[model samples]
Target chain A: MRASVHRAVEELLSEQPAEEVTLPLIATRAGVHPTTVYRRWGSLADLLSEVASSRFSGDIVVPDTGDVREDLERWATAVATDLADPDTLAIMRAALGAGPDGGCACTADRHAQLEAILERERSRGGRTPSVEEASDGLLGPLYYRALFTQLPVTAEWVRGLVRKLLS
Target chain B: MRASVHRAVEELLSEQPAEEVTLPLIATRAGVHPTTVYRRWGSLADLLSEVASSRFSGDIVVPDTGDVREDLERWATAVATDLADPDTLAIMRAALGAGPDGGCACTADRHAQLEAILERERSRGGRTPSVEEASDGLLGPLYYRALFTQLPVTAEWVRGLVRKLLS
Candidate 1:
C-alpha cells in the first residue's frame, strides 16, 4: 500500500495535471478505498509527505577511512550516482518544486533530514565546523548545484573539495 | 501569437493536460483565434518547445576575471540564481516530465545548449580538463548540489570553492 501510494504520486507529478492531487485521486490511483488511504495517512499532504520522505530518507552511509579526502570523494560519488538517477532526482525536483506557495512540511522535513546527516559528518572529526555558516562553507555550493544545474559531477571535484576542507 | 501559445501551454502545465494546451485554450486565455496560435508556431509543441527554451536557456555566464577563483565564483553564483528561479527550472522539469516520449526536442536542445556553454568554458584556459568529466576539478558537485538540494546557497561555500579553484 505504501509503495503503491508512492508510485501514484510519482506518476501524478510527472504527468501534466489532469486533476489536482488529493485524497480521492490517490485513493483511486492506488485502487484502495478512500477510508483506507485516510486511515493510513490522514490527509493528502500527509500521505504525499511521508511517501516522499521514505523514498530517499534512509541511512547516512558515511565512510571514515581516516582520509578526509577519500571519505569525502566516496560520499560524493555515491551521492552523485543517486542524484543522477532520474527517478530519484525527479522526485526531489517535485518536492523542491515552486518553493511551497503556502508551506510544505515534507520539503522542510526532508531538508532538516539532509542537514542532520551533514551535521553528523561535520561533527565527526575533531575539527568540526563551529557554526551553521561554517557548515555552509562545506555544503552550500554542492546543494545549490545539485538542485539547479545540468552539470555532471566529476570525481575530481569531490576529491578537490575534500582536500580543501582538510587544508 | 507565439507568446500567446506559450502562455497557454504554461497554463496547461500548471493545472491541466498539455492536450489542453491547444488553440482553443490560447483563444480563451488570450482572447485570440486558435489559428493565431497555429499561425505563429505551427503547433502546440513548437510553441512550447520554443518558449521552454527561451525561458530556461542561457549561456553559462562564464567570467574572465583573470583570477580563476573570482571568475568561478561569479559563474557559480549566476547558476545558483538561475536554478533558484521557479519559472525557468519548472520548464525544464516539465520537459523532463514527458520522459522518453516522442518528440522531446525541448529536453535535448536545452541539454545541448548547456553542454555547449560548458564546453566553451573548458577551452578558455588552454589547460583542458577531461571533456568527459564535469569541469573545474570539483565544480560538478557545486552545480549538482545547487540544482538538486534546493537549499539556500551561502557566500562562504562560494568563496571556498573559488579559493580551491584559484589555489
Candidate 2:
C-alpha cells in the first residue's frame, strides 16, 4: 500500500509540480483511501520526506584510493549528477519548502554521507572540515548553481570547485 | 497603483506563504480589479519577482578602505542580514521556483551587484573571479546556510568565508 502511494506520487511529480500533488490526488491515483494516507503520512511534508528518504537514503560508496581530493571529486560529481536530475531536484525543493527542521530525510542522509567521508579524512590525518563547513563549501555551490544560476553544473565545474575548496 | 499592488503583495506575504498569495487575493487586498493585476504582472512569478526587485535591488555599497577583505565582509554580512528576513526569503523561493531563466529581476540585480564588487577587486590587482564563480563561492554558501542549515549567518561567519575566498 505504501509502495502504491509512493509510485503514485512519483507519477504525479513527473506529470506535475510538487506543490500540485495533493493527498486526495495521491489517494485517487494509488487506489488507497484518503484516510489511510492521512493516518500514515499525516501531512504532505511528511509524505514527501518519506518518498525522498526511500529514494535518496543509502551509504555513500567512496573510493578508498587514499587521495582525499580524488575521492571527494568522485563523491561530489556523483551527488551533483543526482541533484541535476529533474525529479531529484523537485523532491529536494519540496523538502526545502518544508523548512530546515522539517526532517528532510534526503538531506539528512546526504549529511550522513558527508560525515562519513570527513571521518575517513580525519582518520587519515588529513585536514577534515566540520560537516557543516564541508557541506556549505562543496554541496552548497552545486545546489546554488543548480537552483539559482543558469550555468550548468558540469563535471568540469565540479572539478574546479573541488580544487578551490581543497586549495 | 503600482505601489498599492506592491503593498498588497507585501501584506499578503507577511500573512501567508508565497504560494498562497494568488492574484485575486492581492486584488482583494489592494481593492483593485483582478484583471488589472493579470494585465500588469501576467503571472505570480512576475509579480513576486517585481516585489523582490523593489525590495532587494540596489547598488551594493561596500566600503572602499582599500581593503578587499573588510569590504567583502561588510557586503556579505549585509546580504546575509537581508536574506535572513522571512519575506525576502519567500520572494526568493518564489523566484527560484520560477526556474533559473525565469528573469527574476532581484536575482539579476544581485548578480550585477556582485559583478560590480568583483570589478573593483580587479582594479585593485586582486584575484577577481568571474561573477558566477564568485557568487557560487561566496554568496552561495551564505544563501545556502541561511536557507538550508540552522546555522545563523553571523558577521564572524561572513568574515571567515571572505578570508577563505581571498586566501
Candidate 3:
C-alpha cells in the first residue's frame, strides 16, 4: 500500500506542481483510499521527500576509462540530459514548490549528492584544482548549455572542452 | 501614470506564488481604474511584459581594470547577487509563471529578447565567442547555486568561484 501510494505521488511530482497535487487525486490514481495515504505520509511534504530521495539518490555513477576528461564529459552529459527532460524538471519544481516556503527543502540533500560526486572526481587521476585554467571541464559546459540554451551536451563539445581544460 | 503602474506591477511580481494579482487589484494599488489599466496594456501578458522588461534590463557592466580576472570576479558576483535576491527570484519565477510557457503565453518575443541578450554579451568586452568558456563563466555557478541550494549567493562565494575560473 505504501509503495503504491509512493508511486502515485511520484507520478504527480513528475508532472504537477505541488499546489496542484492533492491526496484524493493520488488515492484515485493509485486506487487506494485517500485516508490511507494521509494516514501513512502525514502530508505531501513527507511524501514528496520520499519521491525525491528515490529519484536523485546522489549515487550518480561516474565511469573511469583511464581518462579523467572522458569520465567527466560522460557524467556531465547525463546530468544535462536529466535536466532537459520534462519529467525531471517537473519533479524538481514540484519538490521545491514555489519560493522560500521551499527554502532548505530538497536542496541540501541534492548538494550533498553533488558534493559527494565532485569529491569523487577530485580524487581520481590526482588532478588538483587548476586556477590558471579558464573553467571546470565536463559538468560546467554541460550544465551551462542545458540551463541557458537548447543545445545538447554533445560528445564533440564535451571532448573539445575537456581537452582544452586538461591541456 | 505609467511610472506608477509599473511600480504596482513590480510589487505584484514579487508576491508569493499562491497570491493572485488580478488587473483590478493592480489598478487599486496604482490608483487607476481597471479599464484604464487594460486600455494601455491590452492584456495581462502585455502588462506583465512591460513590467518585466523594465525590471530585467541593464548589463552586468563588466569593468575593465585591464585585468580580465578582476572583471570576471566582478561580473560573477553581480550575477550571484542578482540570483540570490529574494524579490528578484520571485519576479523571475513569476515572470516565467510555471512550465514551458517560457515566461509569456507567446514566446517569440521572449526568445528574441533572450537571444539578443546572449549575443550582446558575447560581443561585449570586445571579446569573441568562446561559447563554452563564456557559458561556464556566466552561468555555471549561478545555476549550480540556484537550482541546488538555498544558500544566499555571497560575494565571497562568487569571488571564490570567479577567482578559481578566472585566475
Q: Whose lDDT is greatest here?
A: 2
The CAPRI-style docking tier of model 1 reads incorrect
Better of 2 and 3 by lDDT: 2
| Model 3, residue A18: C-alpha shift (Å) | 7.5
Candidate 1 whole-model C-alpha lDDT, 0 to 1: 0.51
Q: TM-score for all predictions?
A: 0.58, 0.86, 0.64
- For residues B11-125, write the lDDT of model 1, one tens digit per residue: 6566643323345676678767777666766644355456666564454544666544455567667665665665555554444323322113333333453345455656675
> Global lDDT of each model?
0.51, 0.73, 0.56
Worst 10 residues of 3 chain A by lDDT: A128-137
For DockQ, the strongest prediction is 2
Point out the higher-scoring one by DockQ: 1 or 3: 3
Candidate 2 per-residue C-alpha lDDT over A1-167 given as tens digits, one digit per residue, 9 for 90 to 100: 99999989778877775445678999999999999999998776678778877877773576566877787788899888887788776666655444333324666777778788878888989896788778878877877776666678888888887787777
| CAPRI-style docking class of model 2 based on DockQ | acceptable
Backbone clash total, candidate 1: 26
Where model 1 places Cα greater than 4 Å from the true spot, the runs are A1-4, A10-25, A33-49, A64-71, A97-125, A128-167, B8-50, B58-74, B81-159
The model with the greater lDDT, 1 or 3, is: 3
Using DockQ, rank the candidates from best to worst.
2, 3, 1
Name the lDDT value of residue A96 in candidate 2. Answer: 49
Error of 2 at B135 (Å): 1.2
Stretches off by above 4 angstroms in model 3 are A9-24, A32-50, A64-67, A100-125, A130-144, A160-167, B1-54, B59-71, B93-97, B101-132, B150-152, B160-167
